[model samples]
Target chain A: MALLEIKNLHVCVGDKEILKGLTLTIEQGTVHAIMGPNGSGKSTLSNVIAGNPVYEVTEGEILFKGKNLLALKTDERANEGVFLGFQYPIEIPGVSYATFLKQALSCKRKYLGETPLDPVQFIKRLKIRAQALGVSDDMLKRSVNVGFSGGEKKRLETLQMAFLEPDFCILDEMDSGLDVDALRVVGQGVGIMREKCRSFMLITHYQRLLDYIEPDIVHIMINGKIVASGDKLLALRVEEKGYACYK
Target chain B: MAQKEIENIIDASYKYGFETDVETETAPKGLSEEVIRFISTEKKEPKWLLDFRLKAYNHWLSLKEPQWAKIKYPPIDYQSLYYYTVPKKKKNLKSLDEVDPEILKTYEKLGIPLQEQKALAGVVAVDAVFDSVSVATTYQKHLAEKGIIFCSMSEAVQNHPELIKKYLGSVVPYTDNFFACLNSAVFSDGSFVFIPKSVKCPMELSSYFRINARHSGQFERTLIIAEEGSYVSYLEGCTAPQRDENQLHAAVVEIVVLKNAEVKYSTVQNWYPGDKNGVGGIYNFVTKRGLCHDYAKLSWTQVETGSAITWKYPSCVLLGDHSVGEFYSVALTNNYQQADTGTKMLHLGKNTRSTIVSKGISAGYSNQTYRGLVKMSKNALNGRNFSRCDSLLIGNKCGAHTIPVLINENKTAQVEHEATTSRISEEQLFYCEQRGVNPEDAVSLIVNGFCKEVMQQLPMEFAIEAGKLIGISLEGSIG
Candidate 1:
């Protein structure tokens, strides 16, 4: 069975329908890239899968590991080993990154009936991950995402995902506004966390991000539906030519 | 004086209704020269102290309760409340263990475990006062070893009479205001702290005041003096049981930071607020002021999350060159609570500086205001100050206001003031809920984020407690 499967999903925000009849499935140990132009319901799909309350899944069934994924709350989904690297991370002042990350990690542990990491052990783990990601000590000490550069924020998100060691990862345009060097860092971080039991869905408009992190399959999404699917070369074709061909 | 006839005013129920009647020593219920004399005589106060109280009593009769604040309540019957009450049945306990069970239970109900455990280990001493008298004070001898005099105000007059005659009424004079005047006259008991020169207080000195029973007012006086090059941080918390008839609680606090010394005073006021209809609650009219003498500094940080009606303005006077002043506050009002509180910074010394940050949260039918002033004297060359006041309204029925006054007479002085009012946006809440957080948790996270700036100013131990308090108080604020 696939790690996450969606069958002919229909989603709406408020009274307006956004995602129409979208079907996709991803097995473990693979990276799937969803490339689409703006207003093509790419972000809507990402948000809906994350259980964003603003988006109503009018008609669809999302199954994760044989369980109904639609029944889970946002945090519940997070606790169930699902991680969404947000495109625009929320800036929560007064909540330090260290403090928030610790809570998120322990929240998952508590759900798994495991003992939470003590502060000393947690900080020791955090320092190694943060150092590897080039996240400065000052940045980790500050309020989460408050005054963080775009590149720093993306790297921080990836660092959190690495710490969480989720079974499935969703990158919602995580490469936007990132320079080539920062993209390499983020791509490498995601590459390190990809194991046999893990899967990923990279949602982006441009195919450039796919160049750094090669995907097993590339799907072209348009008008709330994936119109075409192919292999690695398909990403290059779309990068050279645009989504116009798929349209 | 006897309990006056109950007036048929707005009848409301108090929410924090609990009381303890112990074998306490109390003067007659009234405010008169004879009452002051009786208190002075009971405490064995010096002739000068007695004369001071008499003069303050005469001045208090000449003044009226200021009506400038936005709080509304019935008039206070000063004659019907006991001005002095002390536990005559005590054998002078050494710690909280030897204290009476009823008094200990009162503190415990208020969540103040006066134990020597790590949770409350940092607390240096406590002046646990009930109604109009102090019941117990801990760790006086340890503080005394360092030449630090920490005791009740009345006890200070009896022990350190010279210090009382000099500094008493110097920072907050007898005629400072109506409440201060009244407090000076019939002020029965309060904490008196004196830190000698170049000494850092070993631990935090705290005072917990509880108002039990109805129809009785609580008038306590607090005076803190940090001598030259000394430092101290003091905390004060107050609460009262619920009642249907409005009760009066008028207090006066004064701090003097001598040259090269610094004093930080923090208050977590959770006085009993009347029910939703705003019936019976404590009329919290208080006057707190501090003076930063030459080359000294003073800071007032408060988290006022309770009170049916709160009227206070803790101010600072920068009279010494290069002296500094700061005020950080987070005032949350729910139900029918009305709070009109802020601070004042007066700059007289050259190169003096001041900073003010006020965060007000209003829910239910409450009203919260931030009224402050920053004044720079003509002789204060190169004076600087920055003030920011922000208010967050939780519901449509609440109101938030900011009234700031900045006066600069010196040409080189710099003054900046900013204020903003924001309501809980539907978009923010939806964003959190989309993340699967419940409505209440989402609201609390956002509110905590909003007040992050002020919360950062608190000490490490207090910051955690303050954050939890904000979260708990904001529960049910969102619909």
Candidate 2:
């Protein structure tokens, strides 16, 4: 069985189907990249997986570590070690980043039947994770993405992903707004967390991210379905030759 | 979710409503001259007080309950309510130890630990009033040492008659309204605080009013007088028992801040919110008014979250030049509660300034309204006023309204008023839940955020309880 399996998933936004019979599978200890042009339903797939209420799954089976994933609520899926790095992270005013992250982390720990870290222990672990992602103490004190710059928000998302330490992560354009330096820091964080029990699905349009965090398999998605699959060089080919080759 | 239900054990309707089974001192069940005499004679009050009560009672009998407020309720049977029920144990009064544990437990249940704290340690003296009498008062000597008279209104009538004679009915005349008139006649007990001239009140003064009787009405009359160049902050909290028969609570509060003096009054009202079906809630019609006499200032901050029906408008009269007035309020109504409360700022002083920030939250078939008035006189040249009223509706069946009456006469005055009514969007709550916060916690977080602008103005202790009260009041408001 695949570590994360998507079998004939069909998702609809309102009355129109967005994800049409899409299927994919990734084994543990591997990274898979899904590259697509605009209007390819990449963001929709990430949100549907994260349990966005707007998207209705008409038909699908998403299995995460042998458990049915589509039946869980968004928070349940999160506590079950499924993380989604949003393309546009929400700006929640008056809610401090530290408070939000602590609650989320404690919730996940509680779901695992593990003891929640005391404030002191939690803060100590938070500083370590935050430092690994190049997050400043000031960022933790500020409201969640309230006035963050574009690069800072993407870095925050990366910091959240690192702090969560999920079994699998679907980065939805996580590298979109990052500068070269920020993207490198995020890539280094991801590389440091890469292990045999962890898997990642990188969704991006550019090949620059693929260069830093190389994927074992690169799939080309078009009009809601994966049409092409290849190794790392396929991303380079698409980067230089454009998506017209896959189309 | 089951854990949530268990944790909500304390979130049950205001539980301090235990009516003492013993009855000794009681007045006739009606607002009559005989009842006023009965209360005055029971307390051994002087003839002057009996005359005062009789005069006010006569005026009350001639007037009718005002109908201008947006609140509509079943006619209150004034004749059926036992207006006065003082505890018979006051005959053995001594120290805090002599106080009844049941009365102290009432405060403890209300989250006010009043017994052990050194009375003089804090600046605010608390007068705990239960049912129809003052249960206990703290920091009497300390307040007296500073020439600040702090006691129950009945005690003040006997001990500090000169101050009462000078300031009573001055700010809020007995003829002001029906509630005020009735309170003037048969008001059982409330706090009376007086700060002498040029003295800064060392502590906050507070009165906790608990309605323990079922059919008996609570008519408290609080009067705070800040002499020239003095300053004081007073707080009041009210709670009632759960009952199926509607209870009437008509209170009158008056404050007089003299020249160059400042007074701040804050209230966190959590009366019994009738059952989900709106069966037995309190009808709260209160009259609170302040007068800024020649450069004095008065500010009112309130967090109102209970009552089946609330009709109040704490107002200020700025008569002094350069005087200031402010009103910050957050009123939440859920599960059949109806609240029509706000403030009235009348600027007669030159260069006077006023700000009104009112927030209304309505859910579960409840209705809330922010009705405020800003009246600027012709002499209010260079005066400035800013008013913002925002309403948040939780369920589709609830409603929120903002009615701002702005009367601007001076062209030089700058008056800006803004109002917005919005529903608690699914996006906001979902954003919180996505962070692993449960639905109830998410709703509370958003509601707290919305009311932070007003809650921040509350005192440290009050701010914490007010936040918790908001969370508790919203227990079953959301699914």
Candidate 3:
């Protein structure tokens, strides 16, 4: 069974249709890369799947692990092992990164019917994961995303994906604002998370991110629909062609 | 979620609205010289105190309620209200056991057990005031060993008459304002603390006020005096029962920080706010002021999340050279509640400094305002003040206003003010929700973060309570 299945999804934001008709499916233990130009409904699909209230799902059904995903709220979708790495991570003043992640982890644990991690125990795991993702202790102490550079925000997103250990991860332009060195760190940090046999969807405009994390299938989205789906070579193909023919 | 669903959640969410039923004594349903005499005579006050009350009452009769605040409510009928009420008791209790079981249970239910055995030592010494009288004060013996007088206002009048006569109404005189004058005339019972010279209070001194009587007004007066080179941290919390009719709570708090003394005052006023339509709640009109001597410091941190109508301005008078005054507040109003609260800093000493950080969160059609004043006298050379007022609105209809008045007579003084009003960032809330925190909890976290500066000013234990109180006050504000 597919890990996530979206059938004929139509979404809108304030009567302006963003996703006209979109359909996609991701199986377990798979990496899917979505390549799309700006204003091609790629973000709408991700937001609709993540249960963003601003995006109204006019029609269609989303099935995650054979259950109706549309019936759940944003937090519930997240607790069901779904993660949406924001394109431009929001800054929350006065809320430290460590505190935010702790609450997130506790919510997931409670949803799984498991006991919350003791603070000492939780800190131990946090330090290990944070170290692996190259997130400094200083960043963890600072307010979430406030005053952080682009590379820093992306690194934090990678760190969160590591800590959450989501089953299905969606990286929405995760490689947009990263330097080469930082991109390597973020890509590899995210690449290693998928080594545990989890599924992921990487949305990027370039094929550079594919060098760090290989994709099993790459989908090209245009005009609110998936235009084509192929193996890794298609990403290289789109890179050379510049998406002019896809229109 | 539908709009009606959100309204349902907000209207039905008042966890601390339960009323405690106990036999009580109440004065006549009117205000006059007789009521003042009745309150003073019932407590067995001396002639001087009665004369003071009569003078304040005469002054109060000539004055009218001020209308400068940015709040609206029906005219309060003072004549139709109970002037004073207390839990009926046979005699003064020597021990906690002698206290009424029902009253003891009421405090216990309110998360304050008056019994000494229930709480570990070195945490807090509480003087519990119910309605209009002090029920019991714990850790008095332990506090008394250090030459500290931690007792109720009534007890202070009896045991330490000199301190009561010397400091009572000294910082805030009876004619200061309408509410303060009313409180001076008819104030029943509140906490009184006198820390001796050069002694640091061993434990936190706290007062818990509960208004269990219906249709009765609670006018309690608190006075604290920190002697030279002394230090003390005082905390007070108040809550009232849910009633369809608005109850008046006009209180006056005065603190005198002597030369080289330091005092920290914190209040978490969680009076029962009326329902979504503003049907019933407490009218919390309080006047709190402190006087700082040479090299002394005074800080006022209040977490006000309750009360249907709040009109308060806790202020400080920087009197001596190099004195410091700080005001940190987080006033939250929701569901038709209205709050107009802030602080004032009067710099009279050379190089005196003051800081004000106010965070106001308004939701559910409520309105709030942050009104402040900073005045530096001509003699206050190089005085300084920094104030920041931030307001966060949750829904579309709620509003937040900031009004700051700063006056500097000294050319060397520096004053800085910054104000910002914005809706609770949807991006922040969505980020939290995307990370598995529900909308309600997300709102709470974001709001707490918004008020983090002021909340961090609170003491450790009180900070946690204030955080939770903010969460509860914003319940059902979002779906």
DockQ scores of the candidates:
0.19, 0.37, 0.70
Who is ahead in lDDT, 1 or 2?
Answer: 2
A best-first ranking of the candidates according to their DockQ comes to 3, 2, 1
lDDT of 1 at B324: 95
* Top candidate when judged by TM-score against the true structure: 3
Which one wins on lDDT?
3
Clashing pairs in 3: none
User: Which run of 10 residues does model 3 chain B get worst, by summed lDDT?
Assistant: B2-11
Candidate 1 docking: what grade?
A: incorrect
Q: Where is model 3 more than 4 Å wrong at Cα?
A: B1-12
Task: Report the lDDT tens digits of candidate 1 across residue range B1-479.
Answer: 00000011112233346877667767887778888899888877788878888999998788877888776666667788877666555555565666778777777777766664523664557778887777667778778999998888867877888887888888899888888888888787888999999999988888888888556778898999999999998988887886777777889998999999999998878787777677777788899999998889999999887678888899999999999999999998877889999999999999999999999988777898898989999988999999999898776777898889899999999999988888766555543443334455656676777788887777667778777776666655643
Q: Write the per-residue lDDT of candidate 3 for residues B1-479, one digit (tens) a residue.
A: 42322333233377777888788989998999999999999999988899889999999999999999999999989899998999888787878888889989888888886888786456888999999999999999988899999999999998888888888888999999999999999999999999999999988899999988988999999999999999999999988888898999999999999999999999999999998888999999999999999999999999999899999999999999999999999999999999999999999999999999999998888999999999999999999999999998887778899999999999999999999887766677678889998777787888889999999998898999899888888888877
The superposed Cα distance between candidate 1 and the true structure at residue B68, in angstroms, equals 2.5
Error of 1 at B106 (Å): 3.2
What TM-score does each of the candidates earn? 0.89, 0.91, 0.98
TM-score of chain B of 2: 0.94
Model 1 stretches astray by more than 4 angstroms: A111-113, A245-247, B1-58, B72-98, B108-123, B242-246, B273-281, B363-365, B393-397, B421-446, B449-453
Candidates 1 and 3 compared: the better one by lDDT is 3
Docking quality class, candidate 2:
acceptable
**C-alpha RMSD values across all candidates:** 6.1, 3.5, 1.5
